[model samples]
Target: MKGEKMMKQNQQDTPLYTGLTRFSQQHPISFHVPGHKNGAIFPELAKNTFRDILSIDMTELTGLDDLHAPTGIIAEAEQLAAAFFAADRTFFLVGGSTVGNLAMILAVCSAGERIIVQRNSHKSIINGLELCGAVPVFIAPEYDQTAGRYTQPSLDTLRQALRKYPDAKGIVLTYPDYFGKAYKMEQMIQLAHTYDIPVLVDEAHGVHFSLGNPFPPSAARLGADMVVQSAHKMAPAMTMTAYLHITGKLVAKDRVAHYLQMLQSSSPSYPLMASLDIARSFLATFSQQDKDKVMTSVKQVRACFGQGNAWQLLPATKLDDPLKLTLHIKQGYTGFQVARYFEQSGIYPELATNTQVLFIHGLQPFGELEQLDNAIKHVNDQLKFVEKHATIEVVNQFPQKLDTLAIPYQQMHLHDIVHVSLHQAVDKVAAEAITPYPPGIPLIMMGERVTVEHIKQIKHLIKQGATFQHPDIINSICIFADE
Candidate 1:
C-alpha cells in the first residue's frame, strides 16, 4: 500500500512498512547481531522482532574487523560462508543483494563490454548497467499472460543468444525467478562455459533453495561462476544479510574483493554481519534436518490443498525454492483478502498480489497447515471483495521481434540519457529502466532506444493497471538519455 501511490514513477518501491523498535542503549543483552547492548526486546520488538531487530548495530569493533576490506572476524565470517556454500570465496553482505549484484557485474566485466543478460533481472542489475556502462544483450524471459507473469528465459533462447552474441564477455542469469520458476541451470551453465563466459547468478530468492527439498539446486553448485543470495529472503536472518559466492574460470579473487569495497559501505553493520555469519553457520549445521522438517510441512500443506476445498496450492520443485508457497485463492477470497485474513490471525504471508499469495516457509517451525486449511475455509465461508478473478487469460505469442541491444546497445552511454513523459519521450534513448515488475524484466534498460512494440507494451502496462517506477524520479515519467 505504501507504493500504491508511487506506481506512476515506473520504478518499484518498498511497501509501507514501519521500522521496528530495538533495544536502546539502556536495554540489556539477549538476541544475535545486536548482541543488544544487553537484552531487551523493545516494546516494538514484540511487533516484529525481525524489524525491531537488535541494538549493538555499529561499525566493526576491534575484534570484528572491517567488512569493506576484511582481515579479521569479517574475513572469517565470509570464509565460513564460502565453506557452507562450497565456493572458493564468499563475501558477506550486510547490505541487500543489490550491492552484491552490482559488485558482481562490475567485477566480471569491464566497462563497455557487453553481457548477455536476462532482461527480467532485478532493478539492481539496471544499476549495474548504469554504473558500469556495460552494454547488455538482453534475453527476455518467457511471458505468461495467464497470471500476467513471466518465467526465466528458456535454455533454447539462452543458447540462441550465446551463439549470436559470441563476444559477450559474460552471462548474467536469474535463478529461481520471482515467482519461483527456476531455469535448467545444468544446461544454461554448460552453454555459458562453452564460450568461456562466467555465469553470474542473481540468486536473491535462491539462498534457501539448496537448503530445502521443494526448491531447485544452487546455481553455484550447478556451475555458475558467481552466485549472490539474500540469506534474509527465505532463510532465517536479518534483512540486508546476503552472500556472494565465486566459482569456475576467470574469477579473480582480488577483483571480487575490490568490488565489495566499491559497493559495500565502509561502516558495515556489525550486528548484520554477525547475523549473516550466524545464519550461514546455522544453514550449514542444520540444512538437512531443517529441510526435512520443511518437506514434511509442505506435504501436510499439499494434503490440505489436495482436499480441493477452496484454494489450490502450486507445489514447486527442488529446482524452485520450496519455502515459497505460491497459491491461487479459491472461491471469493482474493490474495490480498486471504493475506489480510491471515494477518488478522497473526500470520503474514510474504506477498499477496493480483492472483497469487506467496508464503515463505523457513527453518523456523510453524503449524503444518492444520490451522491454515481451516482459516482459508473460514475466509471462503465469509469474506468477499470487489476484486473477482476471472478465468486465466493466455498471452498472445506475438512474432518474436528481431530486437537486440547489439546495434544501439553498444554505442549508448549513461550520461547521454534523459527521462520524460512516456508520450513526450517517443524517439529519445531511455535514461531509466522500463521494465514490468512482478516478473522484474526490463523491456528497455536505462539507455536503450525504445521501439514501437516496446512503447505499446509500456502503454498497455499503464492501461491495464500495472504500476511503473522511475528509479531516479518520484512522479509520472518517460525516460530517454540525451543524444
Candidate 2:
C-alpha cells in the first residue's frame, strides 16, 4: 500500500506539461515555424479565444524535444506514460488512434500477408489494411442482444481463424464495443499467442479501463502485444491525442517506432502532447473515492430516467462500463428524433442509433441531474406531438462467421471504379467503404462484394434517418466496373 501511494505521488508530476508551461512563460519570440508567432499574428476576432492555447502550440525548441527522436522532456513524459499504463514502452500519438492502427499493421505485416481482423472494427482498421496492402481474414463479432449491438467475436470463431491461418502475421481486434460492452479479451489474447500470432488491439474507447473495477480491463493490461488508445476519448485531453503501447515481446518495439515516425507528421503539436501528459497523470492519480463519486452521480442520473416512462436504460452486464449509458427509446420513436429533442433542450448525447441513444459520462461526477431531468420532460412533452414510428428491431446484419474481401487490397486499383445506383450494385464489388459515423464501423469494406443483404441494410438505415459517413451512399455507391 505504501509503494502504491508513492507511485501515485510520483505520477502527480507532469513533465511535458510543466516544461511547456515554463517555456511559454519565457515568451520566446517568433523565428520559428507556425506563423502565429505565439498567438501574436492571430486574427483579431478569434484572438481572445485562441491566444492562450496558441502560446503553447509551439514547435521543437531547446528543452521541448522532438517527438520522433525523443531524448528530453518528451522521453520523460512517454516513459511516465508507459509506467502508468504498465507497458514495455509507450509512444505519444498526435494523429489520434488512426495513425497507431496504421503503424501497428504496417510494422507487422508485409504486402499480401494475411492478417486476421474483426469484421465490426472501426473504418480506420480497414484503411490501415488498405495502406499496408495486407490481405484480411475477417471474423464476425457476435451480436449482443442485451446491448443491442455487435460486441466481440466468439472464442470459437477466433480459434477457427487461427487454425485456418496459423501463418497469419497478427490478429487485430476492437476490445470494447462502441457502447462500452466488453468480452473475454484476455482469453482471446491467450488463444492468439498460443499460435505465435501477435494480437493488436484498437482499444480506442477503453483508455480509462485501466482505472480498474467498475471499468472493464484494458487490452494493454490483458497481455495484448500492441494496444492503441485515444486518450481524448475518455480522458480530459485535447482531441487527436492518443497513446500506442508496446506491451508484449511478440512485436518489435523499434519497428513500431519506425512506422510511427514514417506515418506521423514531422511537426507535432506541443499542446496536444502536453495534454497527453496531463491525461496520464489524471488516470494515475484517479482515486477510489473519485470512482465511487462518479458511479454515485451516474446512478442518480439513471434513477431519474428510470422513474419516467420515456426511456429504458440498458441493463448493465458485469463487464459493461458504467460511464456508457445506453437508453432505449420506449415510445416507439427513433433515437435520432429523441436525440434531436434533447439537443433542443440543450442536452447533447454522445451518439444516437435507430433505437438507442448513448451517453458518455466522464471520470468526474455527473453534475447536471436537474438539467437532465428537465431534458427528459422536454423530450416526453415534445414526443407527444410527433408522429410515432415503429420501433426498429435489432438484427444480426453480418451473419457470416468468417468472410474475406472479394478483391484483395493490392488488387483494388486494377479494376475501374464507377458510381452505380443501389439497384445495379448487387453482386458487384465495393470500391469504397460505406461506414456509419460516430461509431465509424464500416458496413461494407472497399474490397468486399456488395450483396443484396448489404443493400437492404443500407436502405433500412437510410430510411431510419441514420447518418452515414459518406452521404452519397443514399444516391449511389462506388463499385468496381464490370470486369
Candidate 3:
C-alpha cells in the first residue's frame, strides 16, 4: 500500500515541462532555426499573446531530446504516461490522433492485406488504410434507436467478419462513437484476439477515460493492441497533442515507432510536448472529489435543460460517457437553428446535426451554471417564436451490415473522374470522399458506390444548413467515369 501511494505521488512530476522551463529560464541565445528567435521577432499584433508560449516553442535542442529517438526528458515523460495508462509502451504524438492512426495502420497492414474497419470511422482511419494500400472490409455500426445515432458494430457482425476473414491483418474501430456512446468494446476486443487479429482503436475523444468512472473504459484498458487518443480534445492541452499506446505485443512496437518517425514532423513543438506532460499530470492527480464535483455540475446542467420542453436530452445508457450531453430539439426545429440561438447567447456546443446538438463538458466542474441556465431559458423561449422547418427523420445511413470498396484504393488513381449532379450520382462510384464535419465521418467514401439513400441524406442535411467537409461537392460530386 505504501509503495502504491509513493508511485501515485510520483505521477505528479512533469519531466518534459520542467526541462523546458529550466531551459527557457537560462535566457539562451538563439543561434538556431525558428527565425522568430523565441518570440523576439514575432509580429507586433500577436506578440503579447504569444510571448510566453513562443519562448518554449522550441525544436530538437540539446536538452530538449528528439521525439523520433527519445533518450532523456521525452523518454521519461512517455514512460510516465505508459505507466499511468497501463500500457506496455506509450508514444507522445505531436500530430494529433490522425498521425497515430496512420502510423499504426501502416505498421500493421501492407498492400493487398485485408483489414476490418468500422464503417462509421473518422476520415483519418480511412485515409490511413488508403495510404497503406490495404483492402478494407467495412462493418456498419448498429444504430442506437435510443440515442438516435450509430454506435459500434454488433458483436454478431464482428464474429461473422472474423470467421469469414480469419487471415485479416488487423481490425480498426472507434470506441465511444462521436456521440459518446460506447458498446461492448471489451467483448469485441476479445473476439478479435481469438482470431489472432490485432485491434487498433481511434480513441481520440476518450483521453479522459483514464480518470475512471463517469467515463467509459478506454480501448487500451479493454485490451486493444494499439490505442490512439487526442489529448487536446478533452484534456487541457494544446491542439495536435495526442498519445499512442501499445498494450500487448500483437503489433510490433518498433514498426509503429518507425512509421511515426516517417509520418510526424521532423521538428516537434516543445510547447506541445510540454502540454502533453501537464495533461498527463492533470489526469494522474484528479481525485474522487474532483470526479464527484464534475458529475454534480453535469447533473445540474442536465436539470437546467430538463426544466424546459424545447429540448429532449438523449437517454443515457450504462456505457454512455457522462461528459457528453446530446439534446434533441423539440417541435420540428432543426438542431442547427437551436445551435445558432445558443451561439447568439455566447454558448457554443461541440456540434449540431439535423436532429440534435452535442455538448462536451470538461473534467472540471462547470462554474457557469447561472449563465448556462440563462442561455437555456433564452434558447427555449426564443425557439418558440422562431420559424419551424421539416425535421429530417433520422435513418440508417449504411444499410448493409458488411461491405467493401467497389474500387480498391490502389486502382482509384488509374480511373478517370467526372462530376455529376447529386440525383445522377446514384449507381455511380465515388472518386472522392464526401464527409460531414464535426463528426468527420465520410457519408460517401472514396471508391464507394453512391446510392439513392446517400443523395437523400445529403439533400436533407443541406436543406437543414448542415456543414460538410467537402462543401464544394454539394451540388455536384466527382464520380469514377464509366469505363
Candidate 2 Cα errors over 4 Å, as ranges: 1-5, 308-310, 392-394
**Per-residue CA lDDT of candidate 1, range 325-389, in tens?**
67776644456666667777666777665456777666655674667777666655546434554
Per-residue lDDT over 126-208 for candidate 2, one digit per residue giving the tens place of the 0 to 100 score: 88999989999999988777776778899999999999989999999998877888877889899998898999999899899
lDDT of 3 by residue, 192-290 (tens): 998889999998988988888868888888899999999999899999999999999799999999999999889888899999999999999999999
Tell me each candidate's RMSD, in Å, in order.
10.1, 1.4, 1.2
Per-candidate TM-scores read 0.77, 0.97, 0.98
**Which pairs in model 3 have colliding backbones?**
none
Worst-scoring 10-residue span by lDDT in model 3: 387-396
Best by TM-score: 3
Q: Using TM-score, rank the candidates from best to worst.
A: 3, 2, 1
Assess the local accuracy of residue 404 in candidate 1 as a C-alpha lDDT between 0 and 100: 47
Question: In candidate 2, how many Å is residue 58 off?
Answer: 1.2
